[model samples]
Target: MFWFLLIGLVSGWLAGMISRGGGFGLWGDLATGVVGSFIGAYVFNLIGLSAYGTIGSIISSTVGALILLWVIRMFNVAPAAAKKK
Candidate 1:
């Protein structure tokens, strides 16, 4: 539980930095990062990769955060496009 919160906070901070002001508040970011961690793990598992309990896990979580940001951006842009049309 503590690990999840810490990981989530760190990952969320990184994700927010990478996204260039695209993320929400602390709680929101934390939630995103935590969920991203799971997503990353699932992805790694699906592709026959191992997400162990170390730095590799952090990397995997960050990768997942990147993917999550990409997804958020995609949906975020949709409304703009629709409004323009």
Candidate 2:
């Protein structure tokens, strides 16, 4: 549980960092990032890629987190002209 939380924080921070540097604040980024970690882990496992418990695992998780965040951002970004129309 504790390890998961730490992983969440790290993954989140990394995700936020990779997401174009500074749109969301720390807590918001962290929250998005934490959730992203779970999504990332799930996707990774589904793809038959295994992340061992090592520095490499952390790196891969971070990459996965960034990917998740990117996808989420795309979904959340409403088309401005569409909104007006």
Identify the leading candidate in terms of TM-score: 1
Q: Estimate the lDDT of model 1.
A: 0.79
Q: List the residue pairs that clash in candidate 2.
A: none
Clashing pairs counted in every model? 0, 0
Q: C-alpha displacement of 78 in model 2, angstroms?
A: 5.2
The positional error of residue 35 in candidate 1, measured at the CA in angstroms, is: 1.0
Name the lDDT of candidate 2.
Answer: 0.68
- Each candidate's TM vs. the true structure? 0.76, 0.66
TM-score of candidate 1 versus the correct structure, residues matched by position: 0.76
Worst 10 residues of 2 by lDDT: 22-31
In Å, residue 9's CA in model 2 sits off its true spot by 0.6
Best by lDDT: 1
Tell me the tens digit of each residue's lDDT in model 2 across 34-59.
67666777878888787778454566
